[model samples]
Every structure is written in C-alpha cells, then in structure tokens.
Target: MKALDYTILTLVIIGAINWGLIGFLQFDLVRVLFGDMSILSRIVYALIGISGLYAISYFGRIGKAME
Candidate 1:
C-alpha cells in the first residue's frame, strides 16, 4: 500500500508538471514523447488521471497518520 501510494503520488506530480508546461509553455511532454494523438500518449493521460483520482485519498491517509 505504501509503495502504491508513492507510485500514484509520483504520477500525480508528473501530471501536474505536464499541466504546468502546457499552461505556461504550450508543451506536452507526454505527446512529444509518444506522438500526437497516439495510443501510448492516450494511455499515459489515462494513467495520470487515474493516479490523480487515487491521490484524492492521500489526505485521509495523512490525517489518520497524524492522529
């Protein structure tokens, strides 16, 4: 569970960075690496979305840990 949390967190961070790049520089690292509209790029985007959803539970875990 701990490793899973870390992995999801890392993915979320990567997604955040990608969004930052898109917002500020008009660049998408995933599309650049995988090709525009490629299946691989789509998978990467989906995984990032899933990771973001998983990360929503992080606050609950942290609150429990702090107790």
Candidate 2:
C-alpha cells in the first residue's frame, strides 16, 4: 500500500508539472514524446487521470491518520 501510494503520488506530480508546462509555455511533454493523440499518449493521460482521482482519497486518509 505504501508503494502504491508513492507511485500514485509521483504520477500525480508529473501530471501537475505537465499541466503547468502546458498552461505557461504551451508545451506538452507527453504529446511531444509520444506524438499527438497517439495511443501511448492517451494511455499516459488516462493513468494520470486515474492517479488524480486516487489522490482525492488522500485527504480523508490523512485526516484520519492525524486524529
């Protein structure tokens, strides 16, 4: 579980950095590396999305842990 959490968190951070690059510089690292709208790129995007959703549960878990 700890490994899973760390993995998801890392993915989420990567996603955030990618978004930041896209917003500020109009650059897309994933698209650049994988080609625009390619299957591989789509898979990466989906994983990032899933990770983001999984991260939503972290707040609750942290709250409970802090109690």
RMSD (Cα, Å) for all candidates, in order, is 0.8, 0.5
Which stretches of candidate 2 lie above 4 Å from their native place?
A: none
- lDDT by residue for model 1 (1-67), tens: 8899889999999999999999999999998999997999999999999999989898898899999
Q: Please report the candidate that would top lDDT against the real structure.
A: 2
lDDT of 2 by residue, 1-67 (tens): 9999999999999999999999999999999999998999999999999999999999999999999
Candidate 1 pairs with clashing backbones = none
Candidate whose TM-score is highest? 2
**Which 10 consecutive residues of model 2 have the lowest summed lDDT?**
29-38
For model 1, the stretches where C-alpha displacement exceeds 4 angstroms are none
